[model samples]
Target: MKGETEGRFHTPDVSSITPGPRRATLRTADGVRIEAVHDPCAKGPADTAIVVAHGFTGAATKPAVRRAAGVFAQYAAVITFSFRGHGKSGGRSTVGDREVLDLAAAVEWARSLGYERVVTVGFSMGGSVVLRHAATHRGSGRGRTEAVAAVSAPARWYYRGTPAMRRVHWLVTRRTGRLVSRLGFATRIHTKDWDPVPLSPVEAVPLIAPTPLLIVHGDRDPYFPVDHPLMLAAAGPAQLWLEEGMGHAENAAGDALLGRIGDWLIAARPAA
Candidate 1:
């Protein structure tokens, strides 16, 4: 990263220099145009693959996201994309409901590139999306996800315990808040509520059984306390990790932690 100056380009580092990703526009099953980027593994065509799902108010080009992608790229091929209503994608966000389609689209793209084992790693809202996506498309679709991991995700919807979550509710529900989010956060989420509310992460995690699940959380997270990941852990046979001082999302994820995530993905792969 560069100085505190705005609009200054970051000096590239060898550790963070991911091979040029082939950018493409992927159409979701619901006909949304999702902007996706595929970064082939530095090690060439390996059977294993990793699909990265970003959190709310996240985009593919963000430094944290790009750093994670670069780290993961060292082990397996990586695919990162912007969900609908965020970044360069089309259509409005239904929060996590319709967002599952975005992840499915990315997973399908990975399979299209001939990756046999696709392991999905998601953060926050993206964590919820991946859990639902794996359950909804379980044992189906061309690139049916083989393994799943959720980090800093809520167990249920409409949680407003923390001030951060309460503010998040405001951003997703109020018109004025949406405008603020558009102008300030650069996130274009719909103001409308979920029509026929989709299943929550707790509900979806159970269905992810037999398909290895990893649930990672931070004890110091402000938006959600320990209960969220614990409730999710109780629902199924998931490998749980409770970090000491981490806060929220990818921004809190350090290089060492990211390396462990990459190791988890590599370990999650079923023997070919």
Candidate 2:
């Protein structure tokens, strides 16, 4: 639904609600040490845990990420982490290619925390990771998600349809850009390209059927147009929300939008 609009909702401030102690370092199957944090629900004890995956150059500690987590904590226990090469985590980012392993580690850790159900919410680069993670671990219990929400995710890889994406391409593909990313953004980029080009998000979405899926995108997103979310919605039974006046990713997400997402997570159920 190109140009479709939704009512705007203002985000609430929850900066005073600090996240709980940092979790122990998580070890990915690929051996990356992922840093994570857990925030108990503000409403009360909950059986579910929401794992948040941040976009490129974003870490669990970023203000935007923390703000989102604070909002989510009102629904369920929240888990937020940095992918490899972002924040204090080890190794370099393969962008979204190998980040699924990072997500898996986070999901598994959440499960270990005694939560009966674990769902994932990811933004931008993180959005692609959650989609691929759900598909990749569909058959496995360790990382299989109960529900998945991908916000502002690309349907396919190598998308340079917009100038923001073109700039992102430069950040990942060029050494000078990588340096800038490290110094300015504190995100490290891998020097190599995807060898086999892992499963794209559109290809992964269909595989996530039976697992409740929600694809949320802003009509005014600069990185990816509505086509991205539309392609994802068309690929599977995902519920799509083409929000009006919204920008992109966590930064653009309002507390009202995040509250709706948390409400969805609370209501969503996996297929029997």
Using TM-score as the measure, the top candidate is 2
Candidate 1: Cα lDDT at 156:
96
Q: Estimate each model's TM-score.
A: 0.90, 0.92
Misplaced by over 4 Å in model 1 are 1-19, 269-272
Q: lDDT of model 1 at residue 132?
A: 90
The residue-level lDDT of candidate 2 at 89 comes to 91
Query: Model 2 — TM-score against the truth?
Result: 0.92
Prediction RMSDs, each to the true structure: 7.4, 9.1
**Each candidate's lDDT (Cα)?**
0.83, 0.88
Q: Candidate 2 residues 1-272, lDDT tens each?
A: 01111111111222323344445577787878778877888877789999999999999999999999999998998989999999999999999988999898888777766788899999999999999998888865978889999999999999998999999999999999999999999999999989999999999999998899999999999999999999999998889999999999999999999999999998898667
